[model samples]
Every structure is written in C-alpha cells, then in structure tokens.
Target: MPFDFSQSHFVLFGLPTTFALDRAVLDTAYRKLQAEFHPDRFAAADDAQKRLSLQIATRVNEAYQTLKSPLARARYLLQLNGVDTQEDTNTAMPVDFLMQQMEWRETIADAKTQRNVDELEELNRQLAEEITELTVELAELLDEQHAWSDAATAVRKLRFLEKLNDEIGNAIEAVLF
Candidate 1:
C-alpha cells in the first residue's frame, strides 16, 4: 500500500527502465509486493483499506506480467520513451520478413497435415532460435543504441513471430492428440 500508482512499472518493481530484465529478480520483487499488498491481509481492515489493497495487488500483478514477457517489456519501454509501436495501423514489414512468414506458415501447415511431430518440433526449435536472436537484437537496439524506431520494427517482427509460434504450438497439440 506504500506503492505510488504514478510510478512506472520498472520503478514499481525496483528495476531499471530497460528491455532486458532478470527474470529471477522480477520474480522475487513480485513475490514481495504480492505479500505486502495481498487483499486477504486487509480483510480485517475497513472497506477503504481492502479496496486500496485490492487495487495495489491488481497493479502489481499487471506490472509483473508486463515485465516478465520480453515482447511486452519491449513495447512498454517504447511507450515510456514516447514511441508508439503503432502495431495496428502500421503493418508495412520488410519483404524478406513477409516471405519468411509465408514459408513458416507453409511448413507449419504441411507438418500439421502429416501429423509429423518430429518435423513440427524441429520447426519449433528453429522458430525459438530466431526469437532468441531477435530478442538479443531488440535488447541492443533499445537499451544500448537507443534506436527507438529500429526497436519498434523489431517489436513488430517479434509480434508476428509470437503469433506464429502460438499457431505452431496449437499445431503440435493437434498432432499429438
């Protein structure tokens, strides 16, 4: 309940305002904040206290979720710097990336139709590697270079990859069962 709602999520978690964060540190901070602001702790208090506690708990949970996710953290950092990703309206991606996306979708469809778990798993590994590489690049662009525009592009690409990754996961599940 000592939390200031106006503070940025990074400050709320006692973290630097950067895209790259230590998950362990975030997890620890989240646990501590949750323990302090948990609604049950204020159950015996007055209604106002309980309401405030619930609000703080909700904010803490939201901050924890945002920081824990790489893509979300990147987007949040961009927002903090007054850079809008414009994900909805700005859909112009590089041609190579669009081609790569098409290829990935084709591969996924084929793997799913054949129910090829091994193939799907291989595709998953490849996609994961690409994601990792992009994440590293994104960290450098946002934290080191301060290239907000490039970072926004990287975020858009990551968003596409994340969606495809979800589809791949579903395809794997369908193939399994």
Candidate 2:
C-alpha cells in the first residue's frame, strides 16, 4: 500500500512537513485506511499477515496522534529538518518574551494573593488568546513563509506558553477545589 503506517506522518498522508493540516482530510483518510487494513478483515490470512496488520494499525494510530497536535507536529517537522530540540535542553526565550512571561506570573501571583477567581479566569483567558495567536504565527512561520530558523525560535516561545497554559488550568482547578 502507498500509505505505509511505518512511514512518517508526512509520508503516510502525503503532506508537507508543517503545522497546518486539513483535519477533516486527515480524519477521513485515517477512517478509510483503517477500514481497508483492519486485522479483522484479514482474519483468514496467515499468522504473519495478521501480525503485520496489527503493527500497521498501531502505527496509524500513533501517526494520527502526532499529526493532530500542534506541538507534536512542530517537533516532528523540526526532527525531519535535521534539527534536534534536545530533550534536556532548557528553552531559552528572548528578553521581551521573558518579561511578558514574568508579567503573567506576577498577575497570577497577585490574583492568588487577593483570592480573586475572576481575575485568575481573566488571566487564563488572555493567555489562551495569546496562545491562539502564537499558533497562527507558528503556522505562518513554518508553512507560508518557510522560515524554519525563525520558526525554531517561535517554537521555544510556544513551549513556554504551553507550560504556562497548563499551570493556569491547574490554578483554576485548585481554585475550584
């Protein structure tokens, strides 16, 4: 089959290495491909064939997940381009972005001290909006403009936003609790 589950997501889906992808197309293709090579459909086949089918099915699920998430997709694109974001490397962001992050942290800290859930929620909303804007910026940098070097820097910022976003969610949960 042309769509080899063992192949990378880009190869399997015939997509370019980019964050922006047609979700509908990916989902539809996955469903159709699943239907075709489902192990159950090959129940009458030999043991090796059935095992191979199972392996291929697992690969398809893994690839789908990696492609679905923006962060994962970005990391994958980086790897494909011979860039390795070291697993242990601490993300170093620019001073302006660091200053913005510090402001966010201060706001969160101040809100917590004041015991203001509304303020916390508002901060979360703002961060969420910023994350959305960064996501679009990432797509433009990686796909439209072909700016990998710049995109690499943006990805580092994105990692920070992701961490902050998770912290905000946890903060909300703590408030609710």
Number of the top TM-score candidate: 1
1-177 per-residue lDDT for model 2 (tens digits): 334545678777667666889888888878876887788987998998888888777777888898988877877887787776553485677788999999998887777777778988998889889888988998998788878777777778878888888877777777777
Model 1 deviation from the true structure expressed as Cα RMSD, one decimal place: 0.8
In model 2, the clashing pairs are: none
lDDT of 2 at 134: 87
TM-score for each model: 0.98, 0.85
- How many pairs collide in each candidate, listed in order? 0, 0
Model 2: lDDT equals 0.80
Off by over 4 Å in 1: none
User: What tens-digit string does per-residue lDDT give for candidate 1 at 51-107?
Assistant: 999999999999999999999999999999999998998989999999999999999
